[model samples]
Target chain A: METTTLIPTGPPATRPRRSPARLVRAAAWIALAVLLAALPLYIDTAWLKAGQYMMIGAVGAIGLTLLTGQAGQLSLAHAFFLLVGATAYTVLAGPTDEERVIGLGLDPGLALMGAVLISALVGLAFAPVAGRLRGIYLGVASLSLVFLGLYFGQSLDSLTGGTSTGRTPATFELFGFPFSNGGPEIEVLGVPIRQAERIWYLFLVLTAIAFVLARGAVRGRVGRSWRAVRDNEAAATAMGVGVARAKAGAFAVSSAFAGLAGVMTVLWFDILKPDESEYGTYGINVSIAFLAMVIIGGLGSVPGAVVGALIVNGLPQALTLFSGDLGWFGETGGGGLTPILVSSFIYGAAIVVVVLFEPGGLAAIGRRLTGLFRARPREITREETS
Target chain B: MSAPTLREDLVELQVDSVTLAFGGLRALDDVSFTVEPGTVHALIGPNGAGKSSCFNVISGVYRATSGRVRFGDTELTGQRPHRLAKLGIGRAFQNTALSPHSTVLDNVMLGRHALTTGGFLSCGLRLPWTVRQERRHTERAVEICEFLGLGKVLHAPVAALSYGAAKRTDVARALAIEPTLLLLDEPAAGMNAVETAEMAATIRDLRDALGISILLVEHDMNLVMGIADRVTVLDFGKRIADGTPSEVQADPEVVKAYLGSGSEDA
Candidate 1:
């Protein structure tokens, strides 16, 4: 074999031109993030609670972004991790003095830590099988986890509170201060923030951390390997990437986030019940909701995950509020139908739009808009020079 | 052209008694050959001659039914592709295997994956050292891409590249690994005269600069004869002749199998 090696001539680096449109879009994103952070203070108590839910949902969605978006692995068992964490919290921290049902008699803070650790361990257990399977096979394997979780949640009465449902203990005290039900008030800029606001801030901090970590992952070497595997597995193998390990690691990371969300969910609601409906329980529907968030945001974009979570979560809440005032259906039926059915249809429709037209999701749209605006000045300058 | 004498004690890759059978049909029948290092080795034959099968076996894409493949002292018969890669064996497919959606830089960086150590968490966290490593890898990929005259399209998506450019990108990606043994499956199959000459020069440069052994599989006899140090001719899954380019080109069996009727046109 004659070995021919071509010396590559380096292309001259050119500075990217600035665009007003890109500036506007970036400003829009900054404005949105700022608005979201400040939203709790400006909104009503109901909407503030809903905003908190959306932020939590965004955190879970960011994890899904890593799994499905970057790694190109589909998972439908995210709710299983959520359930595990929530139940672990209740079981571990439930009334230390009461007649315990499979209770470990651990403190709430310790229980939360234990919940996260246990969920992470369980995620690792499923990683091997999940990693071995690809595309639809992986999807089916992960979906099975949800069924397994549901079975235990319903049948394991000692561990779970059973089908009857159970309340979590009030006052998850940290540093000798209560965090549940209007515990401590903090005055911020002459505005007194309630216990819920404090909890919201905690969730926000976690969400921010998740976003930064996910962003770094997507932009780094690991992210590149994932894209390579997703694009061409054979080539990736040829490049000496451990395809199975990369896929499995993505699943574990995604599951860890779900577990964290579960802990927060229990703290927010003061309950852990598996038999409750999709909205109430961390079930299959919640998994779908998370998937929708990723798809709408942009499959591989970190920022897209947050955008998607807000769209998918916020739209339904807004619609329900609208439906309640309009009285479209019966008083009791209107709120549920609008959020569940209509929001689902919208979610489904948004996914189709994303897949067909803008596969990059909201992130791609943002990039394009930026590029368009950035190129304007260059175009004008060229025209003038010519 | 002067006949370059073969080194009597060259540390060649030896394939001994390798047989590959697919169901009832045998693709390779007790095939055996030696590829000398620091020289171009050509594996050429008619269609269904098991040339590709031999390439596949040596590159760890296919396992031999009964044989031993030794690269220096290591047995590479049943190793996985990645393991083989780690052992310094790099392969470029006949079909361009570049990721169409990724940038040229990203595609080449895939080659350096084996060299990098940080796992998912390290990369995700953007550890100071990992970022520095990434910059160095990107620089290397750029250097390799520029070497292949693909620097102009470094940031461009592979999907936007022409067939010839894409093929060159594959070679660059394989070379980025800095392999001890490089396998090129018809690297000049679809290039024009200018591109072919450029490719030939690039191939020679690779050997001189990298000091890696090369295995070239090509149908273009003129191009093969121009650069190959030693050519092994195969017919019906058996080695018909093996010698210096001119010697193999003049062999009666090679003439009968490849250039019918021993014509002057050959």
Candidate 2:
């Protein structure tokens, strides 16, 4: 036997190098944040309301980014999770009505927790099958959940208030202030902001938290493991990464966020009904809309998700206003072609464009724009110095 | 020659009466070999001689149809590759299986995953202790890269590396696991003479510095005869000769397999 000991020749230590382009991008984000913080004072009420919806959608989109982008899993059941949360909140927190037969007598906060927990549990149950199935199979499996949710909502009439819509009680109170009752008015720079402003602020806070958490998740070991598994499952497994566990974890996290969005939606609307035909609740349309947000944004990029939601959500509202004013289709229809159809068409177009031209989505576009701007400054400085 | 100093208390890997059948065809047939620890053991054979299959069996990539594979006290016969790696056995594939999209450092860090603690949450939060662990592992990975003269490309994507460099990166990745038994499956497969010489030096240096046992599978007899302490020659999924490199080289059966019949007596 020959005894040999291999001593690795370690690399020389060096200082961490910072790219100037990154510093410039950081500065731009700071500027954008400051500008957004000041927008309530100048932006009109309609735009502000749209902004609120955008922020809410951003939370759900971030979760979708993690599921599709990071873990290489596709989910079309996001809105179903939202439906669960909203319905859970309505049934649990609403006042008891013997005739209605749909009240759980749970506190609002507790109901919110229950909603999230229920969604997570549902995710956990489906993860084994969902995680094992990849590509088109996973997509089909998740799409089935949408139908299952719709069935559950319709079949359980007494629990879901049936086809006839019912009022949700104004019982949710925080710190002696009744949130459901529309407590206090908000103002910015002498401008009296409506209830929408209050909702906007809440959405903003949630969106910010979601963004930070998503960013943290993407930059860490978990993110690395996810990418490894996504890029090559065999390599990841050989490195001791638990592929199934990571996939399941992504599903649970995504479901939890979707649930949170559902609760937020209920807070905005102040009611939940199984029949969306009347009140817009039990349907496949919302599920499609949310998928549009994820696909339009960029699958894995956090910032891309936010931008995608804004474009997908904001576009239809703008188109609705434009069509009504222009009388493009007909004069009799004031609401214009249904918001769902318009949004869906544009979203479908966006998905195609992104897949063909820029697969990285809006995030890649943002990076290229920032890079171009940064390079210009450097070129100008060099010319002046020379 | 006197028995090597490191021979005492040696734990030899034993593959006994192993057979592997895929569908109707038999890939391996009753293969048996004993590889002594602390020695450079070489497995050489012609194309389709089931050399790769035996490597796969020992590294837990394939379960044998019959017989057992023992790496020291552990029965690695049916264990998964990752589980086998944790038991102090590491493998480098013949063709580089490195992550092309990841940086060299990140690729190496994948190997150190089994040693690291702190789950997803801690890593995401950048906890103080996990940060410390990450930095330490990164330093170790850098060291391995430098040892293989890959320091200059540590931050570069593995896709950007030369064929030989990429292969070395794979070897570095295996070394990052800190295994007792390292398996290099055709490490010199596509290397030129200069790269092959460097690889041989690195292999020798690996043994000298780490004291980790290595089993090299190769087709190049000159490279094998140069560094291998003991060479085992296989032909048609059966062991033909096993002894010192010179002894195996001089064996009539081994020479006949390499050269055509009757030329071996030359």
Q: Assign candidate 2 its CAPRI class.
A: acceptable
How many angstroms is residue A210 displaced in model 2 relative to the true structure, after the best TM-score fit?
2.0
- Per-residue alpha-carbon lDDT of model 1 for A49-71, expressed as tens digits? 67777887887888888888888
Cα lDDT of model 2 overall?
0.75
Instruction: Please give the distance, in angstroms, between residue A130's alpha carbon in candidate 2 and its true position after superposition.
Output: 2.2
Worst 10 residues of 1 chain B by lDDT: B1-10
Q: Please provide, for model 1 over B1-266, each residue's C-alpha lDDT reduced to its tens digit, 9 standing for 90 to 100.
A: 22143223234688898888888778888877787777878888888788888888888778888888999888988777677667767777678787787777788888887877686668767899988877776767777877777766777788988878898899988887767778899888888888887788887777766656789888778778888888888888788888899899789888888756746664
- Model 2, span B1-266: residue lDDT tens: 21234534446788887888888777788888887778889999888878998888887668898888998887888786667656667778788887786777788777776777665457656788877777777777777877877777776778988998899999998887777778999999989999898889888877766666789999887889888888888788788888999999889888788776854345
- List the DockQ of the predictions in order: 0.42, 0.33
